[model samples]
Target: MFKTDHRLMGEKEANNSRKNVQMQEINKRPRINLPALRDFLSQFPGKFQRHLKSRFKRPTETEGANRDIFKLKDANFSLEKQMQAWKKNPVWDDDQPPSIEVVVPEGSLCQVNVKTKVGLPPDAVYNIVTDPDNRRVFKNIKEVLSRKVLLDEGSRQIVELEQAAIWRFLWWSGTISVHVLVDQNREDYSMKFKQVKAGFMKRFEGSWRVEPILLDEKLCHPFKPKTLSEYMSCTQCNGRIASKVTLQQLVEPAIVPPPPISWYLRGITARTVEVLINDLVEEAARIKGVSATDLVTTNLNLDQALSNEIQTLDIKERWALRRRNSRVKERKDRF
Candidate 1:
């Protein structure tokens, strides 16, 4: 008897829920208007004018003096006539030159002490030297926007990226020119950048050259006599110095990788990879110190969160696999 009563109560509740849903559907029916909104707007000029003006200013003036000026209907007017009309108009033109141009002294140089030859490859050095982004990389000036490019005699290779002298005066609007030179062998390249018409704090022109030196025992030894006084100290230190010095070590160039078999390869991959790996390792070592073997790690919560995230990802992947299988089956059926 209790089971029968419970079943009856459930059926009664379901019927009541169905009735409530039907009532909601009936109430959601949209009411219709016989007259449209356009008719109402058309009937009221004052309100329409106020609303239209509020929405859009008619890009023209219709006041006492300006009324004649705005009444011209044709969009295509003669340029000569327009110029004549503009001359007659009483509007001020802001495109006038200043009476006295500001004069600034030119030519400046930055004191750059590159300690490691391996720090800059020829191309990287060239790019930094000629790229417009050099300002940001070397100087950290974001406003160094415009630059000009100079090409070789053959008009092929870029050798220089120069900023104009006007650059400092009108920092944003100044012109910059770059000059590039390519010899018979493309490897023999040269670039020269100077502020031509820019107003820079300092103006400078310089060239980069490669030098080679040989490594000797004296140069390699840490305790070897580096100064003349140390050289005179004793034969022990003096014996470390060798007379046969080669021209390879003093100006040793950074190693660059050869081009890959693919034509798409434009840069030295081995050097880039080595530099990136070294930098990453050094940064990691700096951050981690000697904590690799240490047992007391502080990021337990992060480890747990990562584990949970991976599990959730696995579940989502499984669901996606099932969906993909279903789609494949559907496609097969269609075929």
Candidate 2:
């Protein structure tokens, strides 16, 4: 009995030792770095606050006057008259590409303006621009990381989105993450967007405007039925309506590249604007049973364009581009 009791005590000691060892092993496992994560998250609120301050900051008297002048210019602009003027002047060709202008206001604040024509109604153009799933149409955009509706009432909506894009520098490339707050005014067919948070941008803001142009009656040809077998035509025609689309953006990269390179990146930005406008125009034309080739004098194939641009880059840039593309593809496949 004594020997058996001693044996039982020994087994108990061994069991306790093993349990303690197991506990130690569990404690040794890696844990989530909560403090580090919290530190990173703490930065977001400050950034967001600064963005709000900038957005709501009142403009100076001179600035306000300049804004009014711009508004008046836009209001007075007539696409039909411009087209007629171009037709009359040999120097102003009908096949001229869209005009893109850039301005630098204050430090790092870059404003870009793009003017183009689309063969569609304002309503259709507005719908395309305000569509929540814009990534489905715009190929350059890698992903719409997240979209949250903050306000949804009749003609106005406030939305927040997280989007990602891959951009290339001279011999390096990187993915840019942007968090944006968008205020949409459907009544005026305008969308205003500003970046609240970004990984590589200090600020990004933009506006889209779509206006309808009414064609003159003289330019319209009345359809008449001559034979009894011919179908009767309506006497009154409102004539074909064309849409004028304007896109404006202000971007300030977090890390601005050196000269020449910076200019090249700006050029890329302009090209991106062109591509987006062209895509919208093409889609609108398709809805109206018109082919893109008919409306756009110069059609750009985004995939091919991107490929050619990548080829122009040096070896390092090409490698970076490949890596980013792979990562983007993997993310897409995962989703």
Candidate 3:
């Protein structure tokens, strides 16, 4: 989903020159006196901030060159006297490790919550992941079986989850379950998922912790930025790992929605899909009394139902429709 486009020398030069010309054209135009623009942005929320952050991710040559300026100041700051003073701190000799780390098995369920200083929030993150155009980012994973909103009535929040599977071998593939909840309240936002089943039928569950960190005034600008968010376990069997990135710019426009049933045409998640294929292969082997390989590979259907697309209608709806039919009797029985 995220990739850098490398242009040839000729194309790169032309693009740069074109941008310079456009900038000059804009600068030559009369500017509007909008002192209130800052206030307007300060009041802006949600997608507006995301747009601003996207703009920040782009690095100009001038900004890149400024790293040398910092190098000189850092050289002086790293004095022998300061080094000696830092070494004298007793805390440095403490028993705690410098960083915390943990790893869970491939097929286990885990949950953890973290805090971030700034950058993308839950809704933006959810939008990025669920958006079909961004599906490339999660390529090789299992299909998104479902993404139903958990709270539909007056909750002002929604939980969306996808069940996906992949094909690996004749007897085994992998499957995953991802759930994300976006709350209207700023303080409540989270992403959680698990490798519920795999080729070996292993299960794994994990959650993330997200907290917003406030940047120091001096370091909160375009030239220099700092972030400090607590990324630790809120509740889980093991420790957690996290990746933090500052999205300074949006390289492209947001993706548009695909046609209905597009997902049905292609199973989600390629990596863990082997599980579904393996199931079919096992069945084939049992029927044919031969290795799964004996079956024609071209005939195998990797494109199968996504976990979410399956029928999950409420029982009441089923009964109501059945009552209208004469042959199929509406029963009080419930399954």
Best by TM-score: 2
lDDT tens per residue, model 2, 134-235? 776776678888999999998899999888876755567677777899999876778999988665688899899876543332332353222111111121
TM-score of each: 0.22, 0.56, 0.26
Q: Candidate 1: lDDT of 172?
A: 31
Clashes (backbone N, CA, C under 3 Å), per candidate, total 30, 0, 48
lDDT of the structure predicted as candidate 3:
0.34
- In candidate 3, stretches whose alpha carbon ends up further than 4 angstroms from where it belongs are 1-100, 104-123, 129-134, 153-160, 167-186, 193-203, 214-216, 219-335
Error of 2 at 312 (Å): 7.9
Rank by lDDT, descending?
Answer: 2, 3, 1
Could you tell me how far off, in angstroms, the CA of residue 226 lies in candidate 1 after the best superposition? Answer: 30
Off by over 4 Å in 2: 1-96, 170-174, 216-235, 297-299, 302-335
What range of 10 consecutive residues in model 2 has the weakest lDDT sum?
Answer: 63-72
Native-to-model Cα distance after best TM-score fit, residue 145 in candidate 2, in Å: 1.5
lDDT of 1 by residue, 275-301 (tens): 222332222223224232132233443
Per-candidate alpha-carbon RMSD to the true structure: 36.8, 23.4, 25.8
Kindly provide the TM-score of model 2 when superposed on the true structure, using C-alpha atoms.
0.56
